[model samples]
Structures are given as structure tokens and as C-alpha cells.
Target chain A: MKRILATLLACVLLLSCMSFAAAEDKKTLTVWIPQYQFSKAEDAISDQDFWDGVFDPFEVENNCEVKVEIVGWGIYGDTFFTSLVNEDGPDLVYVTDNYDLVKRDLLLGLDPYLTQEQKDNVILWNTAPENANGEKVIVPMDDGVAIGYVNKALLKEAGLDELPVEWDAFIEACKTIQEKTGKRAFLQNWGATSGTSALMLAFWPYYFQAGGKMLNDQGEIDINNEAGLKTVEFLKSLLDAGIFTEDIVTESESVDKFAAGEVAYIVADLNKGNSAFTPAGIDWEYVFSLKGPAGYGARTATDSFAVNKKTVARGNDELAVKALMYITSGAVMDEFHSKIFYLPPFTKDASFVKDEALYALTSAHSEDVYVVEEFSAKKSFEDTLLANIQEMFQGNLEPQEVLTETMDYYNTQLKEN
Target chain B: MQKTFFSRRRRQALIGGAYILPSFVLMFIFNVSPIFLSIFYSFTKYDMTAAPVWVGLDNYIKLSQNKYLGNVLTNTVQYVLITVPIQTILSLLIAAFIAGSLKNRYGSFLRSVIFIPVIASLIASAAVWDTMYKPDGGLINQFINLFGAPSVNFLGKKPTALPSVAAVSIWKSTGYYMVIYYAGIMNVSTEVQEAAIVDGASPIQRFWYITLPILKPITYMIVTLGIIGSFQVFDLVYKMTGGGPGRATLTVAYMIYSYAFQDKRMGYACALAVGLLVVILLIHLIQTLFFKERDAK
Candidate 1:
């Protein structure tokens, strides 16, 4: 009887060791991000400090080994897709809004892993990812707003007391600034070719304010309408006024010109207020949306994080779910905002930013913030529009001609796709 | 004995073949194989991630309909036409000057100076040029201002952007071609030049009649190299302009990159690549037909 007991005990111990080994094997996770996103000023190859501070803490807390890999931003999307299709990608990936994950069907749906209560805890309205079928795909980190950053000193030199809140007034202010300062009042980083996204960022506010929609609910291009024509005319008027620099067609970094005080007002992301404008030490302030005839506001794109479904099926679903939770949590979201100086998407009861100039402008334009869901489609219509706009910018085609051509192209693409 | 001799010859042939077997296999695997595979891909509709679907000659048909192709083709032709002649002529001139006038030590030092740009990284040089082309405080504008001329936007204006980029290409490659010409000039018999001088020919006349005629082979080589190099231009344009201010500088190479990588239209990019290869092959065949070496005495 004693011999039998000893054999049973040994068997139990062996089973326990096997189970422990299996558990340990499940703990490893791989993460990938663009090399430039990490602070690697000295070494260039590795950001040991960032890894030790930001990533290592999480790894220890979660009892996992986090392998951080650097990827080039230009090729990241293509590389990520290739890796995913081959089923050899990292468990987590860092991507920008350019990915349009939902429409592409490239990312995993996290809904199956989370409980209803957990899903509810996630700020769905702000962070929810919409698939091509309008299904939620991932949770967003933040919603960005594109606003006009005006150099107050430059404006004052042009005899402007405050930022203009109307189209005509804005144009007049630009003319005045140009006349007085002998500098370009308005500048954008496109030289002869209309960069679709950059043009959209600059001109979409006017379109929205004019009660124009790029695409209707039926997926028809609406830019050939009267409102859209007016938007084009407005852009042409700015160009004709000599308010734009001569090389506006080819200028890659118009923001640098704004930073150098060569332009009074520039259309840029709100995050630039800290990282770009502030670092340059320019006395700049944000301006509210200029009122158009339709009384609508501006629209901006967003970026989100997504999971790989195949990874979940590989038995690390629990860890992946936990990682999603950690990244999208209020604390982590706030940290991202602080690091990037971007507007946080999640709702937190923190004190309002006390920068009087920024607060006043942000509050005034808060109602005008529109989220564009153009990325929710499998194929982007933006490319076609950009090509047409480029022709217009190059003076090869008239603005109206561009609009008509772009509308037709977009319609064809939608119909076929 | 006759039977044994035939067997030995066969054995020798087999051994010779075996010696080159690995290289032949590698070449077929890496170079020849990929070209055929790419041709197959060109006849398909591939999105890189997904399996390719056969579409007959759809990619070629689609290429004809593509509006951007016209601009890309125009840009590529302009680049080749402008850069090749300029680089070849400038290098030949510089080589002639160095070979004729300069003493040995100074000539080598000057040649080394030109070769420095040839050895320098293209991407790094392009980046420096990008900064120098900046409208605000770039060195180019500063120099332009010194000339009592209005600062012209070099890369910003559509009409000038391509030419501006071409200038950088010429600057980078002229030195390489110069080295080739210098070597060619060295090989030319000094006796012929002395005879030309004795015949009451001026320095320029001697160079035009005697030196140039003799340097035909080098000229042909330079022209061919320039044509091939210009067609494959990517790194400089990518770093400097990104094929923009609306595809002003977009070449077939850049377009292929955009299609295969950015747009994920792998089949289309492969079709473009195949088209480029065919064009290059035709040019090379033409060059070979015209530039064959004369029978040596």
C-alpha cells in the first residue's frame, strides 16, 4: 500500500511539472512599431532606455517577454499585410490612420474575447473600430482634429487683432498679412500636385461648412455639386491672391515655413501645437472653424489598434485581450496623449487645459469636429480625387474639370469594387 | 585508340560543364527564373497578400487606360534624354581637359575630387540637396539671391522640378563617366596626338578629329551606361521629391514601387517592370547593333 502511494505521488509531481512548462511557454508576446516612434537619439539602432522603462515594466507586470521590433514607416503597411497573410506576423502592431484596418479586413475582431461588461468599460464611441461592413474591428487611441495654427506675432504685424471666424475675413486677413509682412499669409505643402489627403485636410472644412459631402449614403461622389465648385473656387482665389508661396505645388514641408514665420496661418494637426510649433518657439494660437454658408465644420481622420484573429486561435487569446485592455485603458490613453501632446479620445474628469488661447478656440470649434468614415471602405476614393486635384494644381485642367473627372472616377471605382 | 579519344573528349566536356554547373544553376534560379515568374505575374491580378488570379492581357490593357502612365512615361523619357547627353558630354570634356593640360599629380587629385561624388551615397547626397533646395533659407536660394536674381523655387515649380532633380543626377554620375573617359584617353596613343599637332591642327581641331574619333568606343559605353542608369533612377527621387508636387518626377521605377508596395497592385507593378525590361533590352540591342568594335589592325 505504501509503495502504491509513492508511485501515485511521483505521477502527480510529473503532471504538475508538465502543466507549469506549458503555462510558461504561453507567456511570450511579440510587438512591432516604427523605429522613429521610439526615442533612440544616441544609439540609432536600439532604444534601450525606452525598452527598459516603457516596455520592460509592462513585460514584468504581465509575466511575459515583449520582443520589440523596429519597422520602417514607409513600408510598414505592406510588410504588416505580407506578414499577416503568411501567418508569421507579430502579435501586436503599431499603425497609423493610413492603414484603414476595418475596410481592408486585415485586422482581428476583439469582441469575441471581451465580456459585455469589459466592452462597456471600453469607451466605444471614441475608440470603436468600424469594419467594411460597418462592424467594430478595434479600439481607437484618439480622434485628431485639424485646425489653423496662426502666429499671433505675424498676425499683429499684419494689423489683425484676432483670428477670423469667416471665409471672407480670413482671406482679407491673409491679404493684409502678405501686404504688410511681405511674406506668404497662407501656405500648404503641395507644389503643382494636389496631395489628396493634404488638400482634404485644408479644403474639407470649407466643403463641410458649405454643406458638401464627398460621398453620400449611397456611395456616390458629391464633389461635382455647386458647394464643391465653390470650395474649388475658394482654393483658386487663395492661389490667385498671391497669398500662397510660388512653390506651394512642390513644397513638401510647408509646416517648416510656418514654423519659420514665413506664413501667418497654416492648416495642421492640433498635436503640432506642442511638438512642432511650440518647439520652434513661435507665438502661435489656434483659430476656430471659419463659418461657411452651411454653418457646418471640419472633418478629420483617426487611427486605431487591432488584433490578429489567427493569433487568438493560437491559444494566447487571454494575453492578447489583456494587452488590448492595457493599451486602451484611460491611464495608458492619457499617457499616449501626454507623450504626443494629442487630444485624448477617452473621457476623463481631468482639469481643462488652462492655456486661455487654446481653450477658447478649441471650445468654440468643439461642435464642428466631424469624423470622416471614408476609410471604412475597402478601396479608397481619395487617390482618384488627389490625381484630379493635382491636374488642377498644375494648371493642366480647370478646377471644375478636375471635380467632374474625380467624381466620375470615384463613381466608377465604387460601382466596380 | 579512336574510341578512347572520343570518350576522353566527352569526359572533358562533361567536367567543364560540371565546373560551371553551380553558377548556371544560381543564375537560373535568381535571375532568369524571376523574369519568367514576373512575366507570368504581369498577366494576373495580384494584391501581394492574396493569391494572384489570371486575367489574360488585362494588365497591359489597363496600362493603356491609366492616366498616370502618360505622366510617368514623359518624366522617364525626359530624365533619360536630358541626363544622358549632359553627363556624357560633360564627363568627356572634363576628361579631355585633365588628360591634355594637367600634370600627373594634379590630374590624379582633380580626378579623385570628381570620383568623390561618384563614391558618396546617393541617398545622403539627395537629402543634402533636399535641404539646400528648401525655399526659406536653403543654400541654393542664398546663392541665387547673391546673383541679384529672384530666388527661384527649384523643386517646388513643376516645370523646373524634373530638371532640378536631373541636375543632381548629372552631378552625381558625371564623375563616374569622367573616370571611364580618363581611362579611355590614357589608352589613346600619344603619337597620334603629336602627329595631329605637327599637321598644323589646333588643340580643339586635334581633339575633335583625332581624339574624339578614337574615343568612340568609350562614348558608346558611356551612353549605354547612362541610358541604363537613368531608367533605374529611384533612391534620389524618392528621398528628394517622393515623385510628387503631383508626380512631376515620377518615373516607371517609382510608379512600379507605388503600385507594388503602396497601392498593393503587384500584378500591375510587375507588368510595368516587364515593360521597362523590354524597353531596356531593345535599347541595348540597338546599342550593340550600332556600336560594335571595328576590326583591329
Candidate 2:
């Protein structure tokens, strides 16, 4: 009877030890993901599907758990800002151009956490995130790139055989479309309620392709530079000729006008140019680069992801890091891009050309992409600059007035800060 | 005996305090504290993430310097002036008809139909109105085209955008004020109304002399709330025109939102908010003083 009691005690101790070991091995990672609903699509192709189809295997194989909370972009600003400041955020956060997290020191820099193998697997776009102090706090997850779209019918009506590649010919085509067809020649989205739209689609490409810089090394307004003057002069000429319309007050109208074939040339991203316009049966062509005075190039915004230090403090940092690496690795990224038209940067390991016919729809002419860099005091500058531009379009102010007033406003805001 | 009376009084006071504790706590947390915080934040440059920096009166100075302030103030006041009195008079007339003239079941059904817009989501209502006011393939345009009128982009053009948005506001709010007036008319002394009727008062005279005076308080409420709502109009403008066509529909409230969230200038937003509050209070004070003098006379 004594021997039997000893054997029972030993079995209980062994079982208890195994339970502790199992608890130490497994972990749970939480991610906040944004969702989009494509037009005419019944069920939303949500981010949860990403976890289920892509990350579920990663979770199972690693013997860990991943929780994906599908949030919408409608309330994303308030919700994300609240969670981040409170430091009660998720393990991984999905954000597009989130410089505040870096400026406020709320996020953990990913440079130290990434492995050599992990670094090689993903395209590290958005390398020069301003005010990050050279630390990559957020790694880009998807392309928010914008390229110009050509309406074939509108172009044909204007008697143009091919899409214009130079700035001069582009304006000429705009003039022809207006003179011949009596339709609006070109649509540059101005007076946009969304400040980002005004800058990204209308002004950024023009500024960049003209060799204009946002700021000098000393962080002063570089408004009087030759590049800026050249670009502003060009835009003013277009406005003076009535090539650009002041009818658009919102971004959605730009898309609607394009879909209705009301404009000859428009600048839009793939989702806007293809998903909305193509499905509506509008004959369209996509262009990446337009040669201007300085050079040939294009720059568009990028959507990205970042890790929270609160998750690191919770000791689930390793799991979150693994999740980011696994999802962005060349193996999964190709599959991810194949489903959506949001193609990643060129990687030799992945095959994005699923169909030869659809290849033109997914590729950009230039790999040179520019993400909007956000700094602490850039908001006031953006507001002042965009307001002047809008006024100029509405015939309230001229390009020279816009230029002078913008510099004055920039200086005033700088002095106050 | 005196000591026992005092003890009983203390116990009564304690019980009363216990009864009102929940509401007091809620008001303190939600309403009272926010007002104080808003006032404090107006003087500080408080970006949402960083620690606030003290910058006294700088925000207010900038607000004064803003070139668009005049337009925003004009738009807000114009909206209020257009919407409030029209809504008040219309709702009162409708409520009177429903209360006195309309048959039993029909009045209820009519009230229900009118109140439908009140209960419908504002965003959804804006969307439906947007489609109706659209330039092409719109109901309003389609109707106007019958008389050979050219297509008008009601929400798109600057001249028509503000008025178009205002019309939607009036349509949405008239029924809500009507219900309020309906309740006020019901509570009015029936005996007074009957005496006026027996004293050879016509139906119009009875309503004008008898019901209108009794509805003064309700009218004040409807008008004041209407003024406030119009002054702070954001959702319709946001959904319909987005304060666009060159700031035609930009209101003070929309400007505040732009400053606070989009521009990340929280101090300036709070300053604007405080300015709005002060203006509202002054208007109410004038209204009260004017009404008090009239009553005394």
C-alpha cells in the first residue's frame, strides 16, 4: 500500500511540470487591421480573411495565437490616436503614413527587432520617414501609390493617338480635348476637403518632377526656389487657360467624373483607376511617369504597419515580430498582391504577372515612389499652402499671390511655434 | 428633543445626497469637467499626443487673423437666421392643424410621416438628398428639365450649395419641432381656448390670440434649439458639399473640426469653440433681457 501511494504522487508531479512548460511555450498576438469594401462587391473582403487564409498557418505551425480585429478607416484617426496615446494599444497596428507614433516615441523601432533573413524577404519602402530620427518605426505593408489614368475615348476624341509622355504635350492634349470636344480638358483635384488628396494627387508629382523640395536642411520654407516657381507657373498657366476645373470639392467627384468620361486626363491610383472605372465599362489607360522640366518620375503615398512597445512590455513582442515577418515575407506577399491589384515593389523572388493581359494594369512605369513625409509642424504649412492653391483655382487669388501668401503664412506659423 | 430633531434632519440630508449621487457623478464626469477642460485647453497648444505647451491668447490672435473667419461667421449666422424663424412658424402651424383641425387617425398618420425624417439617420438622409440634387439623372433636375431649364448641380455650384443644404436642414427639423409644439398645445388650458371660441372668436383668431400666447415658451425652445443646431451644422455640409465650391458652405463648426482634427491645431479649435460659446451666451442673454422687458411692460 505504501509503494502504491509513492507511485501516484510521482505521476501527479510529472503532470504538473508539463502543464507549466506548455503555458510558457504558447503566446497570443493581437493586430488592429483596417478593412475596405470594393464597389459592387457583396461581402467585404475583410482583413480577417488575411489571418484566416494567410496567417492562420503561421499561427498553427508556430503553436501560437493571432487575433485580428477588423476596424474601418472611417473612425480610424480618433480610434488609433486614442489607443496609441493611452498606450493600451494592440501588438501590431496598421497605419498609413503614421509619423506621430514615431515623433511621440510611442512605437518601438523595428530596425533592432528585424532579422537579416526578415530584412531580405520584404521591400522596405518609405525609407525616409521624416522625423523618425532615422529609425523605421513603421514598415510599409501595402501600396497607396497613385498613377495617372487616361480615358481612351476622351483621348481619341481629342485626336491624340497615344497618351502624352511630356508635360508640354500633356497640356497640349488637354487644350485639344477642350477645344475639340468641349469637355473639360484636364482634372487636377483642387479645393479637396481632404488636404492629403490636394497634395498627393495634384501637387506632389508636379513639385517632385520639377525638382522642387519641401524644405531645406535648416527646415525653412523653400518656396522661392526655381523648381517651385517653375511648377507653380505651369499650374497657373493651366488654370488660366481653364484647363482645370474648380467644380470638384471632394475626391469622390473626381472618380465619378472620370467614370462618366467627362475629363480627358486624370490622376488616380489603381483602385480608383481600375476597380471603379474599369467595372463601370470606361475605356482606360494607366501611366506611371510624366516627364517635366526637371526629370521623369512619380511619387505616391504608401500604407504601412508598426509595432507597439506596450506589446513588447507584455512579452508578446517576439510573436508580433514573427507575425510581421511572416506576413510580409516574399512567400506570402506574392499571394497577397495577386488577390488585389496593389502590387508591391519589384522583388525577383515573387511572380506578380499572373496573366500577361492584366500585367499593364498592375505595373508602374517608374519604381521611384515617394511617400509623404510627416513632421511635427507640417500640418499648418499644408493648410496654408492648400488654402492658397484652392483660392487660386477659384479665381480669388493668382499664383504669385499664392506663392507670397504661403511663404508669409509659413513664416508666421513657424514663428508662433 | 432638540438633539433628536437635528439628528433626524442630518439623516434626511444624507439620504437626499445618496439619492442624487449617481446623477451628480455623471454630470461631473461628462458635462462639467469637459467645459472646464475646454476653457483651459484654449490657452494652451495641446496637440493630441504631446504634452501641452502654454501659449496664452496666441490662438485667439491667430483666429482673429484668419481671412476665412468673416465668411464662416457670416455663413453660420445666415444659416441660423434662415432656418430658425421659418422652422418655428411652420412647425407651430403644422402642430396647430394636427391638434385642432385634423381628424383623429389622419393626424397621427401625418405626424408619423413627417417625423420619419426626424428619426432617419442624418447621413442616410443626406445621401438620399444628394442623389435628388445631383446634376444628371436626379429627380429635381429631371423635374426642372420638363420646363426646358438647364441642369443645375445644386450641391456642386457655389451659389446653390448653401441654400440646397439649408433646405434639407429645414425639411429634417420641422417635424421634430412640430412634435414639441404638439405637446405644448396639448398641455395648454382647454378652458381658456373654449371661452375664446364661445366669445365669437374665429378659428384663425382663436389660434392667433389664444394658442399663440400660451406657446411662447415652446416657441422660445424651438427657436433657440433651431438657432443652435443651425449654428453648429456639420454633418450635412460634410456629407453633401464638404464645405466646398470655395468655402460656400463652410460653417464655424466645420472649421473647428478642420482645425482640431485635420490640421492638428487643438488650441485654435478650442479657441474657436470658446468664441462660439460666448456668442451663443450673448445671444441668449439678449433674448432673455428683451423678453423680460416685454413681459414686464
| lDDT per residue (tens digit) for residues B177-260 in model 1 | 998998888888989888887889999898888888888978988999899999999887777776765567878897787667
List the DockQ of the predictions in order: 0.25, 0.33
Write candidate 1's Cα lDDT for A1-417 as tens digits. 999999999999999999889777647766665553332235333433343356666777877777767678555666776776567677776655434344457676666667776666654343465556554566654455677788999889988898686777778888888899898787765541323455557767788887787667775456798888887777777776777544666565668778887778887776677667777889988765667778747776555556765676666656766776666666655554454344645434223242556556666766786665543222234545554555566666777987887666544422223
Model 2 / residue B269 / CA error / Å: 2.6
lDDT of each residue in A1-417, candidate 2, tens digit only? 999999999999998899978867878777887764343566545456755677678878988877888788765755676676775678887775465566567776676777655555455544625334565666665464567778898889878887786788877877888898888767766645555657777777887878877667875556657777777777877866667655444335567788888876777765675577878788987777567887765666656777776777888777787787676666776766656344554333566554343355334344455556555445455655676676666677777777787777566543335
* Total clashing pairs for each candidate: 7, 0
lDDT of each: 0.72, 0.74
User: Candidate 1: misplaced stretches above 4 Å?
Assistant: A1-27, A35-48, A97-104, A124-135, A192-197, A220-222, A276-281, A312-317, A347-364, A375-394, A409-416, B1-26, B189-215, B292-297
All candidates: TM-score: 0.85, 0.88
Residue A378 in model 2: shift from native, Å? 4.7
